[model samples]
Target chain A: MAEKRKIDARGSFCPGPLMELIAGIKAANVGDELEVLSTDRGSAADIPEWIKKVGHELLTTTEENGVWHITVRKTK
Target chain B: MKIVIVGGGMGGTILGNNLARRLHHELRTGKVRITMLSASDRHMYQPGLLYVAVGSMMPDELYRDQAGLLEPGIVFHVDPVENFMLDKRQVKTKSGAVHDYDVLVIATGSRAVMDSIPGLAENAETFYTEESAVRMLKRLRGFQGGRVVITVGVPHKCPMAPLEITFMLHDFFKERGIGDKVQLHYTYPIGRVHSLENVAKWAAPEFDRLGITYETLFNMKEVDGKTKTLTSEEGSSCKFDLLIAIPAHKGMEVVEKNGLGQNGWIPTNRTRLNMEGQENVFVLGDTTNLPISKAGSTAHFEAEALGENIAAMVKVGSPVRDYDGKVFCFIEAGKDRATYAMFNYTTPPDPKAPTRAVHWFKVAYNKLYWASARGLL
Candidate 1:
C-alpha cells in the first residue's frame, strides 16, 4: 500500500492550495497518495484539472463543512 | 435604446453584466440593445496578479473568456475602438464600423506607461498584466538576496499592491532562508506612504516591523538599467539588485485620441459618474480623474451606483442615483495575515491591523469574483 500525506491548505487562495499540492506530490514517493484541504471553492475545480494535466491519478474529491478535500495519487 | 460600452475591463464588464440582467425585459422586447467593444477577448482578474508575482498563483488562472461573462442579449465585439465621436454620439472601431448609441459608458480603464521614465521600460518588472506578472515571477525566482526596491508611481491603480509585495517578499525571502541577506525598500511620490492619512499611520509601524525602508515624496525621475540605479527628482539615488516598479499609468489611447481626457484621464462628475458637460456619457474606474484610489473595489462600488443610475436613465429618461466614492482595500501583510481599510469621500480609512480572518476573506473573494463577473454575486 502507498503512503498517504495530507496538506491542509484551508484558508489559502486559488493556486495556493494547488501549489501546495504540487509541492506535496514532489516530496512523496511514487504511488503515494496526497490529499489537499482547501477553503477556496475554486480548488475543487482547479485541482482536478491540474492533476489531469500533470498525468497524476485523481482518487476522489469531497466537500464537507465548506471545505474541499482533493486526493491524488502519484503515478510516476 | 442602444447602449454601447467601450473597454471590457473590470468596470465595463461589471456594468454591462448588471445592466443586461436588470434590463432583460427591455432587451427581450428589442427596445434595448447592448454592445460591448473590447480590445481583446480576455478578461483578467487583476487582483490575482499580485499572487502570480509571488509564485502563489498561476497566470492562466487569472483570466477568463470575456464573451462568456456577458448575457445572451448583449453583443461582445473583440475589436479595438479607434475613435469616440462624442459630438455625434458614435464610436468608430478599427474595422471602420461606426456604432451609434443613445447611452455610452466609457470604462476604457488605464494602461501602464513604462516609457514615461527613461530606462524604466527596459529595466523594471511590473505585476500589472498577465505577461508582466509572469516576467516578474521569473525575475523574483532568480533573485539572489540583495536590495529589492518597489516604487509607486503617481496616480497608480491599486495603491496597496506595492505594500502587499513588500510584505510578501519579506515572507518569500524568509522562506528561502535569505531574509537576513535581502533588504526591502518602498518609495512613493506622495507626501506619505499612502494617500489616506489613517492608512499611512497604521502602515508606518508595520513597515518598520518588517525592516522595510519606507521613503515618501520621492518622485522617480530616471532609471539607469545598465547601472541598476534609480534617481529621484530631488537628486537622491538608490541602487538595487532588482527593480519592481508600479509603472506610470494613463487613460487609454482612444480616450486621449478623441480629446476626451484632461491630463490623460477622463474628467467626470465625482458624484454622478457622468462625463463633464456630457449628460449621456458616463465614466468609471481608473479611467475617471476622481480623487479616489483606482482599485478594483472602487470599480465594484462605482458599478453599484452606476447600475442604478443607468437603470433609471433607461426607464425614466433621468438618473436619480448618486455615488459616495466608497473604496475598500485588503492589504496583505504576509502569507498568513491581512488587513482591510474602508472609507469614502468624506471619511478617511481607519485601517485595522493584520488578522488571519481578513486573509481568508481575501482568499475567498478571489473565488467569489468569478461569480460576480457572471452577475451571480
Candidate 2:
C-alpha cells in the first residue's frame, strides 16, 4: 500500500510551502502520495511547475477558502 | 568538520543559525563547528532603509546585535575576511588570523556603488545605506517640487526598490500638499518599466494612473552636476530638478581582489550553490553569478536549501536537496497598497493588482525579520 503524507504550510510565504513539499517528498517512499497545503498563491502554480520539471506525477491541485491543496506522487 | 562562513549578512546569518539548530548534536559532540566572520557586530535589516528614506522607520530600529542573533552552537566573530586562499581551504581575516575549514560558504553581499557612475555620487540622492537614506529624507523634505527623475541602474539589490521608492515619493509629496508640483518621472535601463513582463504590465498602468511619466531603455550614462542634467546611453537627456539614482551594485571588493570572480560575483552552480570548480566552497546571496533577483528573500530560500543539504551531508554522508531558485519579494505600491512577485529559475512571476492587505503584511514583516534571522520562521 502507498502511504500518504501531508505537509501543512499555511500562512507561510512562497518558498516555505515549496520547501515543505520538497521535504515531504524526500521522506516519502517511491509511489507514495504527498499533499501540500499552502496559503501562498504563487506556490499554487509553482509546486506543479516543480513537479513537472523534476519528473514527478502531479495528482491534483485545488484551492478552497484561500488555502491551496497541491498533491503529487513520488516517482523516483 | 570546521565550517567557516565569510560574511554575516542576511544570507550568512540565516545559514549559520539554520545549521546550528540542525547540527546541534554534532556540534556538542565535537564532530562539527561553525564560525562566522563578519565586518561588523551589528546586523542591519537592509530592506528597512527604504522605509527610513521615507521617514517611516528609524535607523536604530533596523539593526540587531549580530552575536545576539546567533544560535548557541555557532561561534561568531567580527573579523572580516581579507584574503581567500581557496586552494588551501582557508581564509585570512583583517585581524591577521588564518582559519582553515572543511567547508566554506561565502555570503558576502553586494553594495550599491554611487561612484561607479560619473557625477552620480555628487549629484543624485540615494537610499542604499544609512547615511544616504537620512540624506535622501532631508533632500525630499526640502524639495520645492519640479521634475523629480528616478533613474535605475543594473545589478542593483532589491529588484523592486527603484519602483517602491518612486511610489513612496509620490505619496510623500502628495501628503505634503505638493502632489501637483512634483512630476515623478521614472527611468529604467531595460525596454520595459520592469524586467519581468507581468510586473511591467502591472506597473506601467499604475504609473499612468498616478500620472507618473516614465522612459524605458534609458540606461544611465553620466550626470552633469553643474547643469543638473542626466544623460542616458541611448542618446537621451533629462534636465531634472532632483535626481534619485538606484546605483549599480557589485559584490564585495574582497571577492574580486581574491580572484574569485569579475565584478565580485563568484561563478556558482545555480542548483548546487557551490563555487565553480570547488566542491566544498559554496556561494550564495549577492555574491553568486546566479541570474535571480538579489533580494533578502533569495538568501532566505538559499539558506533553507543549504541548511537541509549541509545537515544531511553531516548526518548521512550526502546532501539530499537542491535549491530551485525560489524568490519572493513584496512590492509597495503607493497609498498603502502592495503586491508581490514570486518565481524560480524555471518560472517567471505573474504579479497582480496591489492591495492594502499585502502592504500591511510587508509592514508586519519589518518586525518579523529578526525572528526569521534567528531561524524561528
Candidate 3:
C-alpha cells in the first residue's frame, strides 16, 4: 500500500510552494504520494517541471477556487 | 525594423519579451526584429538579495540565464556595450561589432559605486549583489553582539531595503537569543525615515516595537574601517561593530562616457520615457533620472507603458499611452509578515495594514517574475 502525505502550501508564493514540495518529497518513502496546495498560479507549471527534473512521478494536478493541488509520487 | 535593446536586466528583458510578443506578426512576416545586448548571461532577481542576506534564501536561486527569459522571436547577444554612437544611431560593442538600430531602448540600470565613500569598499558589507549578500550572511552568522548600523546612500534603488534589513535583523537577532545585546541603528539622508510620508508614519510603531533607532538627515560622507566609525556631512558620527551600507548608485559607465547622462543618469521625458533630444531612443528603470523610487516595481510599471508606446511609435510615429509614474513597494516587516504601498507621481500611496497575506503575495511575485520575463504572464 502507498502512503500519502499532504503539504498545505496555500497562500505561499513561487519557490515557497516548490520548496515545501521538495521537503515533503524528501520525507516521504519511495512510492509514497504527496500533494501540495498552492494559491500561486506559477506553481501549476513550476511544480510539474521540478518533479520531472528530480525524477519524481506527477500523479495529478487540479485547480479549483483559486488554488492549485499538485500530487506527486517519490520514485527514489 | 530593427529594435536594439541594451542591457538585459529585469527592465530590459521584460520590455524585450513584451515587444517581441506584441510584434510577433511582423516578426513572422520578416518586417520586424528585436535584439537585446547583455553584458553577461545572468539575470538576477535583485529583490531576493535581502533574503539571501538574512539566510532565508540561497544566492543560486536568485539568478537565471538571460537568454532563456526572452520570448522566441527576440535575439539575445552576450556582448558588453562599449559606447553609444548616438549621432550615428548605432551602438559599438567591445568585440568591435557595430549594430544599427531603427529604435533603441537603454535599460542598463544602475550600479553601486563603493569608492564614493572612503573606507566603505574595504570595511562594510552590502546586499546589492549576490557576492555581497553571501558575505553579509557569513558575517551575520558570526555576529556575537555589538552595534549594527545600516545606512542608505541617497538616490539609491529600493529605498525600503535598509528598513527591511533593520526589521529582518531585529527578528534574526531575537531568534538567535542576542536581541538585547545588539543595538540596531538606521540612518537616512532625508529628514524623514522614509521618502513617503505615510510609509514613515506606518513604520514608526514597528520601528519602536523592534527597538531600532532611526536617524534622519544623516548623509554618509566617509567611513573609517580601521576605526569602525561612519561620519556624516552633518558632523555626526556613529561607531559600529558591523556596518551594512548601501553604496552610492550611478548609471552605467557607457552612458556617461557617451555624454548621454546628466550627473551619471540618463534624462528622459517624464510621461513618454523617451531619451531627451533623441527621437528614436527610449529609457526605462533605474537608468532614468526620474524623481521616483528606483525599484523593480517602478520599472515593471514603466515597461508596461513603454511597451505600448514603442508599438504605437513603430506603427504611427507617435505614442498613444502616457505613464503616470505608478510604483508599488512591498516592505517585509519581519520573517512572516509584509506590507505594501501603491502610489503615483501626483498622489501618495494609501497606507495598507501589514499582513501575512501580503507576504505570501510577495513570495508569489518572486515566482511569477520569471514567467513575466518570458512574456508568459
Candidate 4:
C-alpha cells in the first residue's frame, strides 16, 4: 500500500515516456501504482501496449488538461 | 532580433525548440524572431531509421509530423531552399520566396553517396530513406538464408551503424533459426570495428559471441552482382548472397555550391560550431567538419549549447557561449540488451579508463539519452 509515484513526460518523443514508465516501475514495489503524464499522442496507445507486453498492470488512462495520464501497477 | 535556421533536420529542430523554450520571454520585447525552413511535413527520427530498415521499428513509428513537435511563435517554412545570398543575408526558396535574417544557422545534414561503388546502387539497398528502409525491411524479412556481407562506406553517419547491422544480423539469424545457414560478414576500411574505442571493445566480444566474420582495413571497391562478389582496393574479394553497404557521405548541394564546404564539409570551430569565415552564420550536427561521429546524440548535445549561443548572440550581440564536444550512443546488440558509450573529445581519457564501465555507461545511456533529447529530462 505505498503511495503512487508520478512522472511528467510531456513534450517527449517516443521511447521517452515508455522509458520513464519502465524506470518508475523499476523503482516501485509490487502492487505499487505509477502514473505517467505525457503530451505525445502516440503515448496514449503505446503505453498500454507496452504495459500488457511486459506483464505490468494498467490501472487507468485518462486525458485531462491537454495531457494524457496513464497509470500502471507493478505486477511482479 | 531575428533568428533564421535553415534545414529542419535534427540540428535545426532541436536548436529551434531549445531556443524557443529558453528565450520565450525575450521575444515579447520584439527582440527575437526564429524561423525554420524545410519541405518535409514529417520529422524522421533518423537514428531509428537503421533499425526500421532491419524490421525492428515500424515505418510509421519512426516518423512524426513536424507540426506537432514544433512550438508556437516559430514559423515553419514548407519549401525547399533554392539558393542562398550570403552577402545580402537572405535565403531564396524554390518558389522564389526570400527570407531575411540577422542570424542564419545552416543545419542541412549530409547525404549518403552511392556513386562511389559501381554495382552498389544496382545490387545493394540503402537504409537512408523511409522508402528504402521499407524496402530493406521487406528484403530482410523475406530472406530465407544466405551469406550476407555488411560493409561500412567512408564517412557515413553514426560510424557504428555497420557494426550494429552486423550484430543485429547475428541476432536476426538466431531468432529465425537460420544462424547456421546465413554467413554474416562485417568489413571496415579502418582496422577497428568502430571509429571510437568505447564502442569497438563491446563489439569485439559480441562479434566473437555471435561468430560473425570481420575484415578490417579493407576499402570496398566494387560489387559484382552477377558473380555475387565484393572486390576490395587491395584486389581481394569476398563472396556474399546479400550486400549491406554503407556508402560514403557528401554534404548537401547547397553547402557545396555556396563555397561553405572546403574539405567536403562546412568548416566550423570544433566547439563553438561557428562558421570559419562568416560572423553571422553558425553550423552544427553532421554537416560540419568536426572530427566526430555524425550521429543524433551529437546533434542533440550540440544543439543545447548552440541554441544558447544563438540566443546570447541575438540578445546581447556577443559570442561567449562554449560547447563541449560530447556525444553518447547506444549500440543495440540485440537479445533485448544494448551497449552504450559517452565520449568527450575534450581532455582525452587515460588509456587506463575501464572499458567495461564505458560500455555499461553506454548501455545505460540508451534510455537516459533518448529521454533527454525528447526534452523529458
Candidate 5:
C-alpha cells in the first residue's frame, strides 16, 4: 500500500528540509509519498537535487506565500 | 543505550543539549543516557578572537560555563579523553576513568600550530587563541608605524580569519592616525587572496581600494627573526617590520596519538559523518577529515544533523538523514560592512556585495551564539 507523509520544515533552512524528507522516507514503506514544506529558498531548490541523485522520484515543487512545497516518492 | 560524547567543544556541547531535548522522555525513564566528557569547564566563542585582536571586543565576553550550557538530562564531566579504545568501545580519560558507549562522538577541535615554521612562534603575532589575541592587541597598540606583513598558512580553523583580520587592522591603524605611516601587505599561500574563487575576486578589489598591498603564491617556508625576513617555498623573500601569521592547524593531540586519522583528522564518511568502517563512532567539527571548511558553523550544522539522527536511532532503531556538507560563514569586510557565504556539497557560495545590515546581523549573532550552543537557535 502506498502511504503519504508531510514533513513540516517550513521555518527551517537548507538540509533541514531535506533531512526531514529523509526521515519521512525512512519511516515510510516503498512507494510511499513524502512532501516537504520549507520556507528556505535554498532548500526548495536543493531538496529535488537530493532526490534526483538518490534515485527517488520527484513529483512536483511549488512555491506560494514564501513557502516551498516539495513532493517525492520512495523508489528504493 | 549509553551515548558517550568526547570533546565538549561546539559540536559535542550542541549535540549533547540537542539529544537531551529530543530524548527527554527516554532520558527521564533511564532508557537512554547521554554523557559529555570535555577537557575544560568553559566554552569559548572562537570568532570573537578576531574582534579581540582588533580591540573591538573584550576577552571576558568570549567564554561561558560549559556545564551551564547543557540541559538537565545530560551527564557532564570535566575529563579529557586520553586514549581511544574503539574496538572495546571505551575511552580512557586523563583523570584515569574509563567510559564505555554504544555510540561515541569525537568533536575535539583543531589547533593552530605556530611552531611548524621556524621562528614563526617567536616572530609572528597570531590571534587564534585568547592569549594570542590579547598579545596581538598589545603588539598592535605598541606598534608606532612600519611595514606590516600578514602571512597565512593552509588548513587553518577559521576560513575568513586571514581576510577579516586584514580589513580590521586596516581600520585599526586608520583609527590610530598611523594609516599613512604604516604599509599593510597581505600574503597568501595560494594564488589568490582567498581559497574560494568568488571570494578572492570580490576581496581583491576591496584590498586595492583600501590601499592594502597583497601577494599571492607566497607560501611561507621559514621565518628568520634575526633578519626579520619571511622566505617562501617559491623562492620569494619579504622583509617585515611586524609580522602577523595565520598558522596551519592540525587535529587534537589525543586524536593523532590514537591513530584515528592522519594529522588528527579522522577518516569519515562525508554524508553519514561516521568514522570510516565504524558505524557507532561519529566524527564532527574539526576532527573529521571532511574537505569542507572547519568552521564553527560547519560543526553547528553537523551537530544538528547528528543530533536528529542519533535521537532517531535510539527511538526507531535506524538512523535517518545525511549531512550535505552545508557550511555558512560570515565574512567581515571592514568599514562596518559584512557578507556571508552559504554552500553545500553540490553548490558553491555566491556572495554578493557587502552590506552594513549584514554586518549588524553578524554582530547580533556574536551575542546569540550562546543560545545556538544550547541548541535553542
Candidate 6:
C-alpha cells in the first residue's frame, strides 16, 4: 500500500509492455502497486490477462490522452 | 597449373563444381587441375539442418558424401590444412605434404563463436554445427516441460533461425500437452523481431496468436548459471530451464589468422563476392562480412554470379557479373504455415515488406534450391 512503482512502456510493441510489467512486479515487494504506461493497443488487453493468470492483483486499466495505463499489485 | 580450394563448403564446392564443369576441355587436356581440401568426407546441406532440428527434416537428408556431391574433374583432399603460404602460392597439410596452386580459393566457411558469450560454454547449447544441432534436437525431444527460451545471439549465421525455433517450440510444446507450463520467450538484438521490416509484418501477427513474448533491441550480454537468467544490454532478463542459443559466428580461423578481419569475416564488395583489397581471392557464404543475410539462397545466388565471373576472369581477365545481395528466407510459422520475404540491400524498396504469397513461394524455393544445389535441377 505504501510502495508505489511506475513503468513507462510507450512506443514499444506487443509483449514489451507486458515484459516490463512482469519485471517491475518481480522486483516490487508484496502488496506494492505497480503502474505501467503503454502505447500498444494489445497491451491494454494483454496486461490484465497476464495479471489474472499469474495471480497478481490488477488495480485498474484505463486509457487517457492516447496512452493506456495499467496498474497491478503484488499479491504474493 | 592447379587451382586449390580450401574447405568443401557452399562457396568452395560450388566454385569447384562450376569451374570443373566450365573448364572441362582444359582439365581433360591436362592443362589445369582442380583440387578441393576438406577434413571430413561428409558434405552437409547447412540450411537443411534448421528443418532437421525442428523435426521437419531427417538427419540423413541433410548429409551426403563429399565424393557424391563433387564434380568428376575436381580432386578431393581428405586432410586438414596446416597453413597457407600466400607468398609461395601453396598450402601445406598436416601430413607433411605441400600442394601448389596457380589460383587459391579459400572458401572455408565460418564456425560458431560459442565461447564469445558468458555461460554458453557451461550452461547454454547451440545449433551452429551439424553435431550440435543433432544434440539440440535430442535436447528438444527429451523435454517434458519447463521454461523455454530461444535466443539469437550476436553475429549469427542465419538470423531467421531463432524465430523458426520459437515457432517450432510452440508447436512442440502444444503437441506434448505442456504448452501452458512452458514459458516461451524469444529474444533478438535487432530493432524489430525480424531484421527486414517486410517480414516483421507477418511475424508480428504470428507472435500475437502464439502468445510468444518477443524482446527486440536487447543485446544478450551474459547468462547467470546460478539463477538461470539470461541478461541483456537494456537490463532485461529471462529465466529459462532449457536454453537453446544461436551463438556468434566467425569465419574459419585459417582465414582470420591471415588478416582477413577481426572475426574471420573478410570484407567483400556487396555486388561481387570478391575480397575488398585482395585480387583472385573471393569470399561467399557465411565467411564474408557482407551486408546481406547469411542464408543458403544468398550464397546460391552469389555462387552463380561468382562462378561466371571466375570463368570470365580466367578467359578474359575481367569480371562479367556482380552479386545483387538478394535474399529470400522462408519463415516456418508452425502447422505447415510459413511466410517468406524477398528484398535486396543497398536499394530503397524498404525492408520487411512481406507479401502473403511469400509463404507458399518459400516452400517452392526450398525444394527448388536443394535440387539445384544437388545438381538435380
lDDT of model 5 at position B170: 91
Minimum summed lDDT over a 10-residue window in model 6 chain B is located at B346-355
- The runs of at least 3 residues in candidate 1 whose Cα sits more than 4 Å from the true structure, single-residue gaps closed, are A1-76
Residues B133-179 of candidate 3: C-alpha lDDT, one tens digit per residue: 89999999899999999887755678778778888899899999999
- Candidate 1 lDDT, B1-377, residue by residue in tens: 99999889888888898999889999999999999999999999999999998899888888899998888889999987898888999999998999999999988888788887898889899988888988988888888799999876665778788778888989988998889989999986544566555777878788898889977656677899889999875457899888899876777877877899743568788789999899889998988866567788888889878988898888998788789878888999899899998877655567888899999999998878888777677
lDDT of 1 by residue, A1-76 (tens): 7898777665432114664565356446889999888766667876787676557899999999988989999987
lDDT of 6 by residue, B1-377 (tens): 67787888766777778877777887889887889888778877777777666666677876678877888888898886768776687789878789987777767777777676788767776776677778878887788788888776655677678777788779877887888878787786655676555556667787888898878755567888899989875567888898888776667787767776646767776676767776766777777656456667667667777878877766777889767766656676763666655555433123343344665665566556545555444
Every candidate's lDDT: 0.81, 0.87, 0.81, 0.73, 0.86, 0.71
The fnat of each candidate, in order, is 0.00, 0.00, 0.00, 0.00, 0.00, 0.00
Ranking by lDDT: 2, 5, 1, 3, 4, 6
**What docking grade does candidate 4 earn?**
incorrect
- Give chain B TM-scores in order: 0.97, 0.99, 0.97, 0.91, 0.99, 0.90
Error of 6 at B136 (Å): 2.5
Q: Give the per-residue Cα lDDT of candidate 2 at B286.
A: 86
Q: Single out the weakest 10-residue window by summed lDDT for candidate 5 chain B.
A: B188-197
lDDT of 4 by residue, A1-76 (tens): 7668776655433124654465356446989888988765567886787676557789899999878999998887
Clashes of each: 0, 0, 1, 4, 0, 7
Give the true-structure RMSD of model 6.
12.1
Tens-place lDDT per residue, model 2, A1-76, is 7998766666443225664465356446899998887766876776786676567899999999988999999998
Give the docking tier of candidate 6: incorrect
Candidate 5, lDDT over the whole model: 0.86
| Runs of candidate 5 exceeding 4 Å displacement | A1-76
Cα shift from native, residue A71, model 4 (Å): 62
